[model samples]
Target chain A: METGPIKQKLEQQWQDLSLQLRAIPINPLERKWATIALLIAALFIGIIMIDALVHGINAPSNVETIDSARLHLSEEFAEDNLGVQTDGSGLITVRMVAGRYSFFPKHIDVPAETPVTFRWVSLDVLHGVHIPMTNMSTMIVPGYVAQVTTTFPKPGDYPVLCNEYCGLGHNHMWSNISVIAKEDWAAPVKSAIAGGPENE
Target chain B: MNDAAVRKLALGHLWVAFGAFILACFMGEYQVLERSGLIDALESSSVYFASVSTHGVLMAFVLTTFFIMGFGYYIATTSLKQPLWNQPLAWGGFWVAVAGVVLAAIPLLTGNASVLYTFYPPIQAHVVFYIGATLLIVGSWVWCLIMIVMFSRWKQANPGQPVPLAMFATTANALLWLWTSAGVALEVLFQLIPLALGWIDSIDPGLARTLFAWTLHPIVYFWLIPAYTAFYVFVPKQAGGFLFSDEVARAAFIILVVFGLPIGFHHLYMDPEQAAGWKLLHGFGTFVVSLPTFVTGFTVIASLEIAGRLRGGKGLFGWIGSLPWTNSMVLAVILSLLMLIFGGFGGLVNASYAMNAMVHNTAWVPGHFHLIFAGTTVIMYFAVAYYLWPILLKKPLFSREMALVQLWTWFIGMTILTTPWHILGLLGQPRRISSVVYNNLLTLSWDPYELAMIVGGLVLLGSACLFIYNLAKTQLSPVQDGFVQEIEYAEPLHAVTSLPEYLNDFKLWNKVIAVLMFISFGVPILQFFFIDTFGSSAWGY
Candidate 1:
């Protein structure tokens, strides 16, 4: 046979080979199984979200814009309002600034059974406060405010660490929170600081 | 096509890729040791950060880009039986990429540029680093352009024939890379380069991060596509079976490229730039992308099962034992899929909006990525290297047994390293730390895991060395007489004489990607420009 004809025959054989490789139709039962798997996953996610919202054990909400450079000057994050602030109604809001290597207001004291709003912003780079043993975490991005409100059920110590890498001192970037009983909590000097809504 | 010339060109690229890979493996071992806080003398934050930056760039950018390009060239030529459209341009692209690697190395090695992998801003690197990165990406873009052109030419010449599965997947990746890299490319050109050059006073980090997020997630898929291509096109044949489904493979690639582009906002779930609604949307898209992976797993496993049964094995799972485990290709896939299962589960957790809080930016993040990228993806790269090394060099592998040992060790080492890493994340150990000096009870609990990681890193380093030695020996060994092997593509169970335009071609899918991207990202990105956002000054050296 001539080279041209032989090459053509081989090409035809290759092309014809596909006929044997056709996909077999999947059983309806398999489709049903797939649907069930998807539904279970969706249901799990739904329950998690509902639980988070109902219990207020989630990322902070109502993020407002902020001047990262002027954070120390901002009324909400002023040195005076740095730690725990309680309004007349005894509701607590924790005001803090997360900078390189440290979270301002190193010791955060929040009253248990009180919905304390944790509002923070990054002075330089991005940081994240992950409260261990709780579902409360939020990013501290520069030029924007991060807010989360949750009430701890009992009084205990919860170590807050910066999850996001900021700089050289990232490993040392951590703070402690001493959650005391609501009955032992003291009143705040600056009531309802930042002049926003007093309570959620 | 000049076969000798193409082989030379492909080998050159692969050598460069493997060279960077071996060097980075050494650096990786040192990193684990230093970070374990066990070696006090090795603990320098600057050195650790610099090593990390270089290691990340070499592995993530250098190794993956070179390997993908080289593999693409070989695939396009061998599968299509056509010459690489522009050989000189391909060589030029290779040189440009090498030069970029060299230029980037200067700062990364000297501790001048220590921005770890991600394009998070304010923590700036040297101007040379950004410029070099641009050049590297630009070179890859040239490869992209060439692949698309070759794909179009092939379709034009052969009117109705189904494109070979390998070539189709390669061309799909080229298209995906083109779409995906534009996000980071724009960021570098406009935001980073200017900031580094002192032209811009500051940058809106939110915008920078949003743009990088566009590239971050899809880039993993870009690295992964070649591995997946091997799974679909080569694994069945090597396992002594036909491909289970060609159409399903094509569909998987289509969903991967189309859905992968617009869903990167999942990476920005914790970031402040994008809203929760957009994150949720991307989160859903992330789940949708997982469908292709499921299809791939089922198809690959079924193909292996068919191979095993045809070899006289019986029962559902017994056929797995009948598989040619000595074959590097077969062994790699089984291990790759095992890693993918764990890695993929970790991905789902990361993609979940609420559940992300538990593991985000923790040790779990690195553990998950290393399993997927190194375990699943790079293991396949090794298989491809082993399979192709002999063909390219026109010699049998120097040591098949060594290759098998290397694969096993790699799989074992990765498990040892990442399992503990995952546990550490759950134990509240954060990632990106140089060391933990002030050891208390909680920090002290991490010691055993850290030691395990050190041992794991050492084993992987040894395996990496073995792989390089084997490839080098194969290339340098004297050619055997009558040693001739032609590339063999796996035939599908049913031959496809014809395919729909969307199935055989990417034109339809490209348009689909454009619309989906606009819907997903257009508003989120434009909102940044419309809103009055403050810019943060560069903070890091």
Candidate 2:
């Protein structure tokens, strides 16, 4: 009779365990989490896409148009296009002559908060016009000026180098980009008046 | 050649290649140490870049090419049961190629030819360097011709039969090399030579880049095929298993040859020389090439699975454990494939056009490539050398334990070296830099990783030395094992008999590659000629 109870208990336990197993069914939380993970991934990717779109749309659409103007790079700046004048809030196109780069331009002053269009082409071997401070590096290929544009918010002196291995003295090819503050233009104007005609 | 003659012949070539390799290994260790900025004495930007260039050329071009040629001659004669076609020409190719290496070495050693082993134009090297590189490639071309001729004659004699897998793979590589080298050959012969020689005042760099792109991408496969050959022919047998599929192996080789050539624009994705559309198409082609690799992975794994099962291993993945871990050949594959996974992932990043911009011309590129080429590919070369050395020498290996230790060290060293490289690349370290003279917080952060890389390099150098030492001992060992083992290729799951002409021949794929390459590279390359391009005045010498 005691054996009967043991057998009954074992049968009862087996049934209960079976019911528990049946109740366990497929895990809904794991499935839900998987979907959630996938959605989150999709959403993250979407956010990046939208952000890129907004940035692109807000960017000036001028870059879509290639400047077919024949840009040249000589050893030195063509005497006529030596000086760069920016009219406060517009694009300034600087003509670059590509050849053996010699002169280290200590200060290339650009108006503050202005976009400067670099129309630079190599007159000889490949060189990159690198603005090290801003991390703007563009290839200056032979027969073509790889056109690029960037707006500088802060005005400061930035080192520039020919990033491409152009020749023996590639290490020596260094210049400076002088970003002029908007307020500083008046100082230059005052200096022009104070110091005889502005020397070219 | 008789047994003694064969051993002597192979020994001479092997010694030179390994000797160069060991010397380069020391240089490599120094490079990592210098690059890490830990050793002030090792710090010379000129020396570092020069050493990097020489190390790359010696390991990738010189050692591998010479070894492969010597190995090929042995395999060809033994497997084909025929004498080498045009023996004089073969020797001529060898001598000429060696001369070219010497020519290139002068500039590389002196820091005059530091273009980082790339075909970037107007990066003026000494004229001798360019000429030497050209000669080296031409020498390989000669080998290519000989391999093809011997292959054809063998096939003609034994019609309706499958070529031995090793010979078949070798021939495929020869064909691949012949086709792949043309782009760079043309670029070097015309553009670079003239520039270096002061003959051409200026060249359209876009064209030069486009031409170089043609060679840049596929040459990787040229380096890789021998490793793949070992995988198909040796691994299964070594693991005590059969290859999953013979036909699949053939198909993989054929696909690699066909697809690898047309996908050159992937290298130019960031460059302005090619249009975005072409780069995108090439990106797609790059992904297409991945299919064959996946096929190889599946086929290889399945073969191993079968082997494991045959060894009385049970369960799904449990068969992995059943594999012969002690065997050098089997051990190499596991490590090589592990490297392949990471290297292949990095390759995915490179193929992704947007991400490529993030790491373009960065340290990440070299990190990715070294894993694939040096880690995945060269490790296998070591395994093959171990397996072949004894067979070629007719003696037992001096130390199986040492060989295994070398393999392990190699894998560990590779991980240590390349992990930092990828991190550095992502952290915005540029490739081919002479020095990081400027130090800021960001550059300072790179120090620990560089340190790790140097440690890895030291370990790898030791491993390289150990490998050469073992081979030496094997050759000189007084005890000879009377055991005779033929070259055993793994049999695939499905038996192959009377395979279609496609499997037996490359003629169709050759035609197909010709057409695809034209479509992919034609417009991108031809545009420079058609466009009204302006000429740049001279800059370099």
DockQ of each: 0.24, 0.08
CA-lDDT, candidates in order: 0.85, 0.72
Interface RMSD of each: 3.2, 8.9
Q: Model 2, range A64-173, lDDT digits (tens) per residue?
A: 21222233234223334433444465447554544454322234566667666655555556665555435344556655545445677788765555555555444445
Query: How high is the DockQ of candidate 2?
Result: 0.08
- Please provide TM-scores computed only on chain A for all of the candidate models, following their numbering: 0.74, 0.55
lDDT for model 2 comes to 0.72
What TM-score goes with each of the models?
0.93, 0.81
Q: Model 2: runs farther than 4 Å from truth?
A: A1-139, A148-200, B2-12, B479-485, B534-541
Top model by lDDT, which number?
Answer: 1
**lDDT (10s digit) by residue, model 1, range B1-541:** 3898999989999999999999999999999999987768998988988888889999999999999999999999999999989899999999999989999999999998888878568888888999898889988998999999999999999998999999999999999999999999989999999998899998888888888988988899999999999999999999999888888788889989999999998777766667766776777778778878877887898889889998878886889889999999999999999999999999888877778877877788999999999999999999999999989988999999999999999999999999999988887777888887533356777889999999899989999999999999999899898898878899988787778666898876888899999998998889877877888888884
Q: Give the local distance difference test score of model 1.
A: 0.85
Per-residue accuracy of model 2 over B475-495 as CA lDDT, tens digit each: 777866576645556665556
